[model samples]
Target chain A: MTLAVLDGGTYYHQEAIYGERLGGRFDRTIYAPELTAADLAGCDALMVADRIHPGVLRGKRPILLDYLVGGGTLIVLGENSAQQWAPGVSWEFRPTNFWWWLEQGGDPGHRIVAPDHELFRHVGMKELVWHYHGLLTPPPGATSLVDITPDGDPQGKGGSILYDHCHVGGGAGRMIVTTLDPFYHHGSFFMPAASRFLGKLLDWTDEAFRTPG
Target chain B: MIDAILLDCEQSETGAQALITDLALGPRIDLVPFYDLERTVLSRTRALLLGLHSDQRYLASRRGQLEAFLGGGGTIVVCGHIGHPFLAELSPFQPIHGYRVDDLVVNREADHPVWAGVDPADLSKRRGVAGFYGRGSNPPPPGARIINSLGPSRCPVDFDCRPAVGGRLLVHAGADLWGYFGSGNSSERIMPQLFDWIAKPSEAA
Candidate 1:
């Protein structure tokens, strides 16, 4: 099973650095516009950064659907603005709670709602949040992982991180959508708090997304 | 009488378009896609705003057109990371990592009129979160002035420069400049201040 990260090459320097440190598991650091169905044939997991141009990706939707339905893993990262296309994803805008960590007796409203989730392994309160782009509402039946709870908010759910597993055309694949963009922030050395969590998530993607031969 | 034309990178101009309407500059400001920037159009164009998320390679390809726009007395407000080599008289980007909220302190040197009515604290903190001020910087070309800094040594976050031929570049090395989101602060004043300065950069001097 091979892993790859799709980039538009705008953040060239950061992309190179992130591609390097994840050991050798992530081999293909590809440009989004040039990505073809053939590229995903042998790939077990494909990660799409938020910076992609939606027009270039417009035609690639079916190719992506095929890959996921064929039991491959696809991860869509966070966007600072509106994102038009991504399979089974709908976004919601939530005012970011940057000061939750700074309040007196600070509650740090972000929490790991889905404790049983594997992505949270070894991850604690500090690593759970930095600044999220917004909230994501994954399609039905997907597991919601982390919630960026604004201070004292009831219901305790706003879906900051999500994992979707489903059957497509009698085959199954996994899709993970997160407001956290470890690839962007980690590469630039900004998300240091989540460094370990990010490392583990990458390892999990390479392992969990592998399809049987 | 278009004062500024923000080459809208749709993905990056979050809440900024709405801010433009609030300023009543919608009619006077041109919001077009990055691909729409061209010499033929820029001749009649005024100030063009390029965000960090705007396509750099695409803009870099139209290098001559950009220079000419400046020479024709147009202003370009590029808000975000400054790495495009095509932008004249600006140094390559200097990536600034691991900076805390306090690290994004505005310096006395950044007292340019562009920052008028803007607060350094507001620039540093949005909803109590810091560190979004800037993630990197570009070297100030000779005669360039620093108006805001990321850390010591004046690694600038906001700065402006005059190219030899013409035009001025007000580069804010951070998210799109606007204060219109739920949080109303000094950042909200940036768009208007920038519009004012772009309208008359000499007065800002």
Candidate 2:
């Protein structure tokens, strides 16, 4: 599948989409400021990074909305605010705990609600104990494939995570948003678990692309 | 007079923006985005803060302005490594070959008021994770006092160099120092230490 990842001038963004082209997942980076509707052509999925400037993204809202409403798969990773750029998404502020995995028997506080879901076929809950950008509350009817356990989170009320999918624009398109920044941790930091999880997630997105809606 | 002018940086996750909101300092963010930096704008400022993710390309090219600002007895604190020739005495950053949060052992080689009773391990972990405090090393400048280090890099995570120009150049090779104020950790002491050292050297002593 042809994947288009947006770059906002970070090493992590470069690695997520352009780092390694493997398993028929040929990822391309769409420079954040320069991305336009014309750049969405022939792309099966569009991935937005966590660290983009909200103002820059607001400028491209029209193009992103167009792609989402036309049966395209749009994946938003990281901290894009719900009130600003993310369509059908609202954000919740959670004190981030980036070091749960470093502790002995540390639980990252997240769980895969849909164990049998395609996303979990490759990656599991153990690999998700790293970090998340923020808690996201998706629109109604959206399936939450995973959730955060209060025990695993320092905040004691773990935020939503793993995978969230929702149909938009009268069910013509599908949008998936996750707080997981596998690309960044893997790209910039060379995190082993994040890399493996990211590959599986990308592969799952590809498999879901071929199956009819 | 501005307490500190944080250089233009990505405000969201990097914590430069959070420092503004959490510290009750508002609207000052508009005054220091590299373009707004001028002799007139900086003359009266007490401090100029540069985060790890600062606009190094813009600030590097305008080193003379910074020198002039320093000449006027301004406090310039850079929180992280730079990509330009701003500090001649300091060495370029050398990435740690095997960087692990555990491998990161904060060792203080010198004493500064900014670290009176502060512990290195306190700054090492944030929200349960480690290593955000310092990732790379800046070769110690002549007479530069080393404050923090990870493992054997000896790269100086936190240091102070008082160049012959009669100004202060404080560098921390990690996240923004001000962001620690609200982390609810012992590292929160960093904010006051930094501010006191900038505002009144005598009190810091």
Best by TM-score: 1
Model 2, residue A75: distance off in Å is 1.3
Candidate with best lDDT: 2
lDDT of 2 by residue, A42-88 (tens): 78888786656555677788888898877677877766563577567
Error of 1 at B59 (Å): 2.9
True contacts kept of each: 0.15, 0.02
Q: How many clashing residue pairs appear in each of the predictions shown?
A: 2, 3
Residue lDDT tens for model 1, B1-205: 5776666555633665675675475666766665566724765555787766665656677888888888888887776554456676665566655566556665556576656777777766556656677766767777777888865756777778888878887777666675344346655666666677777756533
Residue B185 of model 1 has an lDDT of 67
Query: In order, what DockQ does each candidate have?
Result: 0.28, 0.14
Evaluate candidate 2 by giving its C-alpha RMSD to the native, one decimal.
5.7
